[model samples]
Structure formats: C-alpha cells, structure tokens
Target: MDNKTVLQFQSLSSLVDPTFWYSLTKEKIDNIKLSDVPLDIYGYYSYNSLQSSKSNDNIKVPSFLQLNSNSLTNEIIPSFSFPMKGLLKNTNTIEDFQKLDKKGLFEKVSKKIWDSILNGEAIKCPSLLNQFLLISFSDLKKYKYYYWFAFPALLLENPIYLTNTQLLSDYLNKNELQSLHENYQKLLEIPDNIKKGIPGYFLLKKDDNNHVKVGTLSEWEMFKSDDKNKTIVGFADPCVLPNNPGWLIRNLIVLLKKKWNVSKVTILCYREIAGEYADLSQCKLMDIEISGEELSDNLPKSVGWEKNIKGQFGPRLANLGPTMDPNKLIESAV
Candidate 1:
C-alpha cells in the first residue's frame, strides 16, 4: 500500500452491566466512604458479538468492552472474553467529578502506555497497550451515577497502512486452523491466566515444521524467525466488521514499531463466533505497513474519550434512583 492508503479501525464501546454499579455501591457505602482515590478495575470484551451479519442475535453493535459485578473483585475472570486493565476514579461528590482535568487525566493514562512501551515492559505484556480510564461520581442519596470512559490510543506520526485483508480460513488451511484453535485453548487454560485474566494480545507461532503453537508477548524474541510466516501476532478482536479491526490495534502497531523496530506485520483478528468457542471462520487476517517514524518527545497524542449520548464531547449520567434506592423500593412495595 502507498503512503496515501491509511487504515481505519472501529472504536471499542463500553458496556457497564447493572451488577457493576450495585457492586460499586456496596463497596463505596461499606469501604470507600469519603475517599476519592482511584481503584484498580478490570474489563473484558466478548468474542460473540452481535454486529456480524452472520450473527443470529437481535441486537446490533453490542458492547465490545464490559464491566460486571466481579470486575473490581480479586477473583478469576470468566472464559470466552479477552481481559483488559483499567482504573476507576470515583469522586465523593459530583462537584469534584465536574472539576476534574479531563484532558490531563487522559494524558496521564496514555503516558503510562508510552512509558511501558519505552521501558520495554509492553513487549512482555501487550495488554498494557490497551489501558483505559473511568471517572465517576456516585450520588448516594439520589442513587445516580455520573460517569465517563476513555479508551486511550496513541497517535502515530506516520499512520499504518493496510495492504491486504482476508479471512482466517483463506489464510490458513484446515489443519493449521485446528492447530491454532487447540493451542489458543491451552493458553486460556493456564492457571494464572484463569485467575487474573489472559492478555487479549498474544503470539501465534508456526515453526519450520509447520507446528503451530500459542505464546505470550514475552516469547516474541524467541518466537521471531527469518521467515515471516513463522510468527503471527494475534489479538482477541471484538470488532465484528469485515474490514475494520478493533481500536486496540492502533497502539499495538505503534508498540511493534517503536519497541521492536518492526515496520510491517501480519495480524490475526481472532474471533469467537456464534457461541463460546473459537471460530476461525469469523477471524480476519491483516497485512499492514507500520510507519516507524519516531514520535516527537516520545509523547504521542492520544484520542478515545467516549462521546456522550448526544454525540458530543461530554460525560453520561446513569440514574438508578427508581430502581436501586431501597426507600423507593419499599414505598413501591407498600
């Protein structure tokens, strides 16, 4: 592809399950009190999205990233989802939330990503490339939550270009596809991966013997081969579109370019279609050229603060008073 042939990706959409707010409510009333410190939270994107034309589901464009009751807990993340780490900054009052430096907060989170890439940490655990932020104010009395989400992405000085795209089936034979499925399943079976969560980003290695294996980001050095076909970087893609991959691909290209000095790569947009199993038929294979231009001052500009419901740059409000307030529930029952 020429320099003029740029790439476009589908941004990830957040889905905060109701149980998540209930869990936060309990945590706040019981532990947080008047504190405004940020808390570590986790979220995951489901592979079985409804956006695909082949899907039998009713909804369109179902959420890519989701937060549930257990997202803030110290327990195991469930299967069939690719995990991502994030921060939850909950203020004690709405006034405090309103006063926050939104752009500064965005830059802070993005800087962490940039630092990780520079320090070579992101090469070991690529999920750091997908770091996100959430800011909120829980109205205890009114039972309303004012919140916003930001999925930070590094801007490339010279953008990546897509030269080719195809389905996994078209790229690999049936045997190779089976090997990939079995290997990736083993990756999900690792004990620690089950406990915390596995990185959505991973390595797919097909050796000279044509033996395919699944590996983590840390294995990239050892996994690399003279023949480009030997290593394939794959991500558990949440985007259901045929052409556009998910938002996280943006930072991955930058990390690959900056840290490893790789100007081009083949990416597998892995997907699980229809049910709780990996489906190669739904996956997309992409060959792209990453412009390895050095970003000025090593601090790339970022984007991805979620747009409000009105399609403007702002936060959203979730009112739970009628449904969540105990007093209201009791009054309705009486």
Candidate 2:
C-alpha cells in the first residue's frame, strides 16, 4: 500500500522561506519515510473511536473535575496537508511564495479553514484538501506571481447520506415538502436568486431486482458492475452561473464517453443552463425537481457544503439521482 503522509510546520516562521513549501513534489513526498512525519499526539483515531472516547470520559468525570486537566487544555499545533507530489506538476519559484505572503493569502486561507471548523463543518481527508497548486502571478502584464500551496489535514471523515430515509422522512413534513417543491419551481422561474452553486453528476442503474438505484460518480466507481447498462444524469445547482453548468456537463460527457459505454445522456438543470448545453452535446433535458426522497441514498457521509444551513439537504437531492450504465448512455446517444 502507498503511504499517505502529510507535512507539518512546528512554527509559522518556517513559512518565511518560500522554497520550504513550494519545492515539495510528488517524488519528494513519496520518498518521505514514516519516520519523517510527526506522530499524531492522540495516535490514529477513527471518527467513531474519538467520539466514543469523549463520551466515556464525560460520563466518568465532570468537566471541571478531570484528573489530567492539562491534557484537555493543551493546544493542538496547526498543520496543513502537503500537496500530493504529482498532483501539482507546475514548477514554482520562491519569489512567488514571498509575494503571496505579502498579499496575506496565507492568512486568508487559514481564516477560511478556521471559520469552517467554527461553523461545525469539520475538515476531512481528500475532501478538505485542494489537489491543485494555486499560482498567482505578481503582475499579469509583467507576468510575475507567486506559488502558494496549502495542504489541509486529512481530518476525520464525516459521512453524509442523502438516502437516510428516516432523517429525510422526519425532516420533510408535508408543508416543508411543498415549500421545497415550490422553492425549486421558484428557482426555475428566477435562477438569478441562487447565488451558491453546487457541482455534481448522477447515474441511474437497475439492481438485480430491476429496481432503479440512483448514485453519484464516486459511488458508481465503487459499485458499478462490469456489464454495460447505465444512464448518465448530468446536473447543476440552479444557482450555479450559466456558463459553469454547461462547461461541467461537457467535461463530464467527454470523460464518461472515454471511460465507459454510456447510452443515453440526460441533464436535469434550470431551463436557461439546460438550453445552453443542449446544443453543445447530444443529450436529453428534464425539468429540475427537488425531492428528499428521490435523493435519499448514496451521498458522501459528509461534505464541506453542509457547513451552511441552506446547503444541508435540498440542494443535494436535486444534484444526485439513480445510477445507470455509462456505456449504454453513450452507445444509445451515438
């Protein structure tokens, strides 16, 4: 198994040297031995284990009456994930880092992560991390900029399931359901009001029982059978800007066509964005509908978007649907 290692700085001053962070590459990172990485203070604790420990400790003693008070108050040193070696293939310079620091980009990124944690959106592996290198030229005309790299820690995973039938059933009462449906319609009427856009794709497949099962790309990667029988459902949040959804769908279609035998392609999006992509690709378009029940399963256990109340559930459903054979979709379309 490939070792997954992350880099840590003992102090912020270490960042003063631009080469310190930017020079790291996949080769260098992969060459890193387990001994090179700092040991986690609490050892490796899975999400459930950490929660159980906290519960047990709380039950055993009162907060003010703990025997090891210092342990509870000790500050956890802040650390960021190092970019995976090959992931950011761009060559960068030290001057780039210096300029970014001067521009306060580091502080801005730090604060963004801090604010997220404060709002209860815990960072998690691969999800919280940006796999790309952000290069900012110092001057566009002069062609100068800095290379800034941030590797968020592989935090405990937070799993979110859109298909939590109980949770969905309890949360969406008749009135709430109607309001949700109405809100979806309103967005279709006036998409300008949707400021925050979500990017995701869907797949529709039939299980052995022939019951339709809806899933996301990530889920399909895990559960898809070798046989070709699937449909690709392209979706974008209504609030997403017009150009982005079309671009995303086009990219998805190209990617799916290359990897699988996709049959028919269908897009569920706002009318305006749907129209834009309909001409670009040979696919079907459907009205956007928001339903908690339809999208109750095969969702990431936890996502960064859930940090906001508005992003909790409704938006997720509209973006996810049943799984289908990608090859069949492409073949059928062709």
Candidate 3:
C-alpha cells in the first residue's frame, strides 16, 4: 500500500429540476410571499444513478443529487434514496443572498453533524450525516433562480490514506455477493426504515459460515466480530468516477475515526444501476488507514460549500426564463 495514495472525495453540486423551481414559484406566490423564513426541504441520491447506472441503450446518463417537486413534499420515493434533509432559505433580495454569512452557515451545519457523531445521534439516524443547506434568490420577474448548496463536512485531524482500491464485485465471490444483496434487501424492507430514510449507510459482515448480516449504524457493535478487520462499512455512493467516492464519505470517515476509534478499515462504495439492483460491479471497495483523530468536543474546521463551474467560490445561476415565461406559455398555448 502506497502512503502517497491519499484518499480524496468528490464534492457535491446542486441539481435542481425545473419542477422544483415551478413548485417554489407557486409556493412563493400562493403562500410564502416576502417571507424569508427557512423552509424544510429534502434532496436524495440513489443507488440506481445514471453516473453509475446505464440507460436502455447501455449509455451512462448524467447524474445528480436532484431536487424536484417531490423533494419539497413529505412523500417518500423508495428509489429516491438516502434523503438529505435540508433547509431552504429564500432571501428577499440578491443582496441578502450575497451578504449571507456563508462561513457562519457552514460552521453551524457542520457543528450539527459533529454533535451527532459525538453524541451518537448519527449512529442511530444516519441521515443527519448528509444534511444540506440551500440558499437562493428566486428572481420571479426574470424567472431566473440564483442558488448555492452547501454540504458541510467535518475534517479529521489525520487524513485517511487509501491502502488499496478495487471493484466490489471482484472483492467478493459469487456466494458472498448474493448474501450481501439478500441482507440489504431485507434491510430495506423494514417499513420504519423506509419512512425515515437512514438505511443508505450500513454496517455488515460475514460470519464463519459465510452468512451476511446487515445492520443499521446503531447496530454496529452488535454485528462486530473481535476483529475489526473483518467488518466492512459502506454507504450508497453517489459518485460516478471509478476511483473517488462522493462528498459525504469524508465526514463518515471522520465519524469512524472519532467514534469507532478504528485505525484501519475497509470501505465499500456501494453503487448500483437504477432499477437494476442486481448489478453491483460498479461499486468500489477500498482499504484505508487513518491516524491522529482528536477526541476534543470542539468541532473541527468545516468545508464543503459547493464551488462554481469555474472552480471558484461563488453562487450558481439557473436561468429558467424561457420555460417559465408566462407570455411564452400563453403564446405556445395559442
């Protein structure tokens, strides 16, 4: 294992569908006019993502942690998994959006994640690990939406190094893969688990008999054998890249180091084809080692405000003018 193989995580980007803007427009005009209060919203990532999944023609489509009309509602789409509970702050003006305390906001959210990890809340309800912030200024007049998304991550004192990386399919033999799949499906069948949306992050291990048992984060200790090396921790990976895992894995490693106090661990970046749960070859398995995790109660330096297309620190603009223009809607209707 090369010590130079430092593990890196891919950052998050906002993927707002037109339906989301349309719904927000209706919400603002019909209800939340001029109100700057934050609204409860959620976004989700899936195992069956285009980044890792193929289309009917076998081409890989683009993917994202998308927000649409459904994201604004409480309705749960099973396939739209790992729901990231988020806050939506629609500012009254562009100045307000611009002047918002971005660093302050990032710190605040990161603290919550840190607290959850320390107090064991995240171990119980893993969705808190993926909480996000969305600040926006919807220009109703121009039908353009300006927004920035932040997925805050807690930085560990010691960087996690990649010991080795391999395809998950190749890591496990045919029988072992079958057991993992069967147990995972059983985990998803828990109705309460379905409602709460924390099943994406899981702990699993194989017994001497080669039987696999999947458990919630809270059940980690119960499923653990004497050897931490035997246990594998995993998350539903959202990254399409073959090598890099998604952004949330950073804080998860933090949680593992600080909470579990593990120095070496095996990580499974679980990826699957959308609507095709049987395909797991796209998943990546990694062996990583980390040291020097502080037990201090204070939160570490926070990062993960999504960067702009130019890779600069800035907000992104979504000009939905044409599709949202009322005159064009009427004209096209005629």
Best by TM-score: 3
User: By TM-score, how accurate is candidate 1?
Assistant: 0.89
- Estimate, for each residue in 1-334, the C-alpha lDDT of model 1 and write its tens digit: 2333567888888888878899999999898888888888988776655544446444445336788898897354556775678888999877899999888888989999899888877766666788899999888788888899999999887767888787878767777888888888888777665333344777877654545777887788876655566356888788878777889777887877776777777888887665455556778888887876655446989899988899887889888877899999998889
lDDT of 1 at 261: 73
Q: TM-score of each candidate? A: 0.89, 0.24, 0.91
Which 10 residues in a row give candidate 3 its minimum summed lDDT? 53-62
Candidate 2 lDDT by residue in tens digits, 1-334 = 1232221111000011222222222223454322222111110000000112334533211011001111112222111111111112222334433343322432343334334333322112111112112322222122232333332221212211111111212323444434433433343242222111111234434344323344445454643444654333534322222222222233233233323433234343322212212211112233211122222112112111111124331111111011123444566677
Best by lDDT: 3
- Superposing all C-alpha atoms, what RMSD in Å does each candidate have to the true structure? 2.9, 24.8, 2.4
lDDT tens digits by residue: candidate 3, 54-120 = 3454565424677989777857654646678888889989999989887777777788888888898
Cα deviation of 83, candidate 3, in Å = 0.5
The candidate with the higher lDDT, 1 or 3, is 3
The lDDT, on a scale of 0 to 1, for candidate 2 is 0.26
lDDT of 3 at 252: 78
Candidate 3's displacement at residue 289, Å, is 1.3
Off by over 4 Å in 3: 1-4, 51-62, 78-80, 225-229, 275-277, 330-334
